[model samples]
Target chain A: MNELSTLANRLAEKGKESGNGFPFEVNPIPGEVEVLQIVIEDREELPIFISVSEEQILCMSYLFKQDEIKSGKENEINKAMLIANISMPLSAFSLIDDQYVIYGSLSVNSSLDDITHEIEILSDNILESIEAMREYLN
Target chain B: MSLITKILTALRGGAREVGESIVDKNSIRIFEQEIKDAQGQIDKAKRDLTEVMAKEMQAARKVENIQADIIKHEDYVGKALADNNETLALEIAEKIGVLQAEADIQQKAQASFENHTNRLKGMIKKTTKALADMERQFIMVKTTDSVQKATAAITDNYASGSSKLLTAKESLDRIKEKQADLEDRLSAGEILQDEFDGTDDLDEKMKAAGIIEGDSKAQDILAKLKAKQG
Candidate 1:
């Protein structure tokens, strides 16, 4: 038994020296779809979110420029959401069963109308995210 | 009473006494012969046991010597490996492996011989017990009959058998030692390598000979040699 232990130790040391490393802390999820969460300080600089299962960047969302949100027409928020939806292949987010939610607030100085428009825009983006996810599943 | 009646009675009495004496003498002779035979058997058994023990001891000594040689070779290999001379180290390692295998084989043979010796010893013990019992019976008969026998049966049996047993044992011991020496030499590479190498056909030969399954190393070696020749 001691001899076996010694051999195991030697092999482990060899493996470490070879520089092959595992990246994620894999855990068993309750349901079929795997989950990944990323937190950022500022929504505008949203980093690319990669799905661990599919090996692709699934979502990229950034805060809209303040001037465009203010000067644009009423449907601008929905347009921005639609653009974000079309940017990525639908297959990228299929691993997420729940609504793919993106949470961020408008700048404090922005008007009530601007905040409302941003919320609407975010909702449109959510719908587009769900549709993209469905396409991927099919 | 009449004189003729008295004379007839006296003659009958004398005849009866003579018959009783003859029967007593025959019983004594038979008992003595039995003791002699039992003693002879004990002697033979002792001799056989001695021979077995001597062989066992000789095999043991040879095994010890081979073990020492193996340790030395192993140490040499370890030193070579430590010195980073991997080529030399590997060569020594291979040699050590072969020597170890030979030592293992000899050890097994030694164990077998020891077991055989033990069995022979058990037989000798039983024979000795029988002889002792026979002696006791003979003494009981002598006391009851008031007969003085001339033969020192016990002493003669022990002396003759023990001496032969000792001599045979010594001879077997020497033979075993020689066998061990030959094995050691083979391990040390003193024997020709070809002698060990040519035994691959052993299985085929064993099959042909109808020796389906048994541990006959000598036969295996012969078979291997034949295979190599072919």
Candidate 2:
């Protein structure tokens, strides 16, 4: 198996055995690249997708769709995202295929604890980001 | 064209029939190809380095052999001189001159090999760093591509689709509702606690009706005593 597939399996196991208060629900997305859909309990609305590449492990959560932005608010929302990107801890705002996503990148050699911590922060950031962007969202 | 330029061009010209996917496929292929090419270059450079290193070792060995021969010949010249054999000593000294010249040539060759090795080492180092940078950037691009594809596989429209992922609007609505409900529940708890405290209510009613004097201020009481005495 590839490094990503192995990491996916380890993350799933960690999600099950972790007693660190952050419970995760991991589901593998079948595709060319090993992608895992992870949902943190209580923050079920936002699901984070994790994929490991040659040098990095990326964790991303969909923030909103471009069409979901309030009409005529794209410029303002885009600016807000750009500004917030600086202060957002460990995550950045990106537009991918008309979807706005918040993603964080970690080294492939990051420990499981580091990955889990990143997930927890990412989950919190997703909710907080949505809340912050609520005024501009439809 | 550059990858960014190609992607931008595709985006601008209208991707009529899943053109975005086609662009993605092409770009991913390009990245893979580029990465492979870099790897191949690194491999070839390492091979070249090895060859250079091997030559350096050979030159070093040759220089060492020549130096050893020169030292042995010098000893022979010394023995001839000690025996008062001037002709023999002169002949041995001449042989030493030839060996020294050979040693000097080999030493120059060894120095040239050393310079080549250093250059190759520097080149390899630079190439390796560049390769690492390219790989890191590829990771970012590849991960983003995979994420976009995975999301697309589930549903084109996340809000109306059956996917578990919720749009930020819906999530924010739910969060607001939950917050409002929490506020309501907390206020209700306070009201219920007040209603359950029967004696507190009785005390308030008594104070209002003057059936029980409300806790009098010390200043008020003192003033009342002074007025009565006066």
lDDT by residue (B1-230, candidate 1, tens digit) is 43235333433354443212212567778878988887887788678778877887887887788788888988898898889899998898888788778878877888988898787777778877877776766654543222111111211222343322332223234434665886798777844565455453676677668776556768989999999999
How would you encode candidate 2's per-residue C-alpha lDDT over A24-133 as one tens digit per residue?
78877665555778977655667788877666778888888888899999999999989999898999998766778899989889998899889989888888888899
Error of 2 at A2 (Å): 10
Score every model by TM-score.
Answer: 0.31, 0.65
Over B38-135, each residue of candidate 2 has an lDDT whose tens digit, in order, gives 78887887898889888888888988998888889888988988999999989988988988888888788888888987987787788788788777
Candidate 2 share of real interface contacts: 0.36
lDDT of 1 at A64: 25
**Which of the CAPRI classes, incorrect, acceptable, medium or high, describes model 1?**
incorrect
DockQ, computed on Cα atoms, for candidate 2: 0.30
In candidate 2, position A21 carries an lDDT of 70
Off-target runs (Cα >4 Å) in candidate 1 are: A1-138, B1-30, B142-230
Error of 2 at A39 (Å): 6.2
